[model samples]
Target: MSSRDTMLARIRTALANGPAPQPPQPDWAAPVHLPLPDAELAVTFAASFRRIGGEFFYCETLAQLGAELRAWLAERLPDDQQFYVWEPTLQALLAEAGVPFQATEAEFKAQAAIGLTSCEALVARTGSIVVAPATASGRRLSIYPDQHVVLARPSQVVAEIGDALRAVQSRYGTELPSMMSLTTGPSRTADIEKTLVLGAHGPRRLTLFLLEDDA
Candidate 1:
């Protein structure tokens, strides 16, 4: 037989065997989720967050947060690094706290050493911080800067990823943001020679300000 006919006969034999068996479908109804805890979600979150090389600081009140923020800035700045805050609420808080931040957009674009922003919700199970375009920070404040400081309240802490999504729904209803991101920790990669490197893609240092309920 000709090579062409031989190939065609092989294809017909394969087709006569019927279609291939399909792989099993994943269970999409309800995926495995961590149980909501009766213990303090903040504590659970802090532990999980810190385990991945993130810095966690619990502040009892707004005043304490302001003071600690000031102290942190004082220690970190003065090295000719530019600090800026853009979000309206964050700007107001920084102003009220007497914390210095560059408001000029040009300077921020030129060299933004540190960026301060707030988050939507803090995930306790995976130590993930949920963020969306709903906030004034948008995406740049959390991604572009080398150092990111997240100022979050106790009420924003949730037990799981699903809980965070539910909180977002309750806050925004059907008009949800275009995107949602769960930041478990500072950006890191072990792709090169299996040598771990932090800040390879984004912020090298991630500091969280977990404010108390009253704050």
Candidate 2:
């Protein structure tokens, strides 16, 4: 076998008995604050989510947020009962808003779940949402769940991919995590007979809660 093939063989052999490689340690630090255009931020996130076969909502108060969330979940959730998903921060927020909720990390990996969290940055140019794995938004919370609801503050939206990349590099250094998904929309693929299908390997539904603070 060629050198490249030999290396591949060795890698496969090593993996045959070893556990899956753990995701790298993300360099968790704050990004250099750069003020972006306000109207542009709203427009970017709204457009990005829509393009990905998703929906977006804006809520000024926790009450509005909870109401909107319950309404949205009502449609997508199974059966006639309210959805029971796991999100510590989200659960707290829901409770504060007097919305019935519960918490359990054990259920995070279930195929029925919908993950939620506030984001680090929303890149307008690529329509990508950048998330750090170390926060309440655990790596699994974002990837393992079937639906994802991201809460992105207007100030967190960046103008371009380079800016977001620089932000990640500056914070996480060279060895980033096992995954830093630049999720633009619902997971999709057209690999089978050029037929597009959502939720191919990720969330089939993506929703964004864009929060803007009127100063």
Write down the lDDT that model 2 would get. 0.71
Q: On a 0 to 100 scale, what is the lDDT of residue 44 in model 2? A: 68
Collision pairs in model 2: 24-178, 27-172
- 1-215, model 1: which lDDT tens digit per residue? 99999999999998999988999998888658747674678889999999988899998877888899889988776577777777888788778877788765666666887888888899989899998877777788888888889988888988888889999989999999999888989999999999999999889989998877765
Q: What is candidate 1's local distance difference test score?
A: 0.85
- How many clashes in each structure? 0, 2
Worst 10 residues of 2 by lDDT: 78-87
Tell me the deviation in Å of residue 166 in model 2: 2.8
Full-model lDDT for every candidate: 0.85, 0.71
Poorest lDDT segment (10 consecutive residues) of candidate 1: 30-39
lDDT of 2 by residue, 11-106 (tens): 999888798779999766745555556568668666866876768788888778778877887777666322443556656767876665435554
Q: Can you give the TM-score per candidate against the true fold?
A: 0.81, 0.70
RMSD of each: 6.8, 15.1
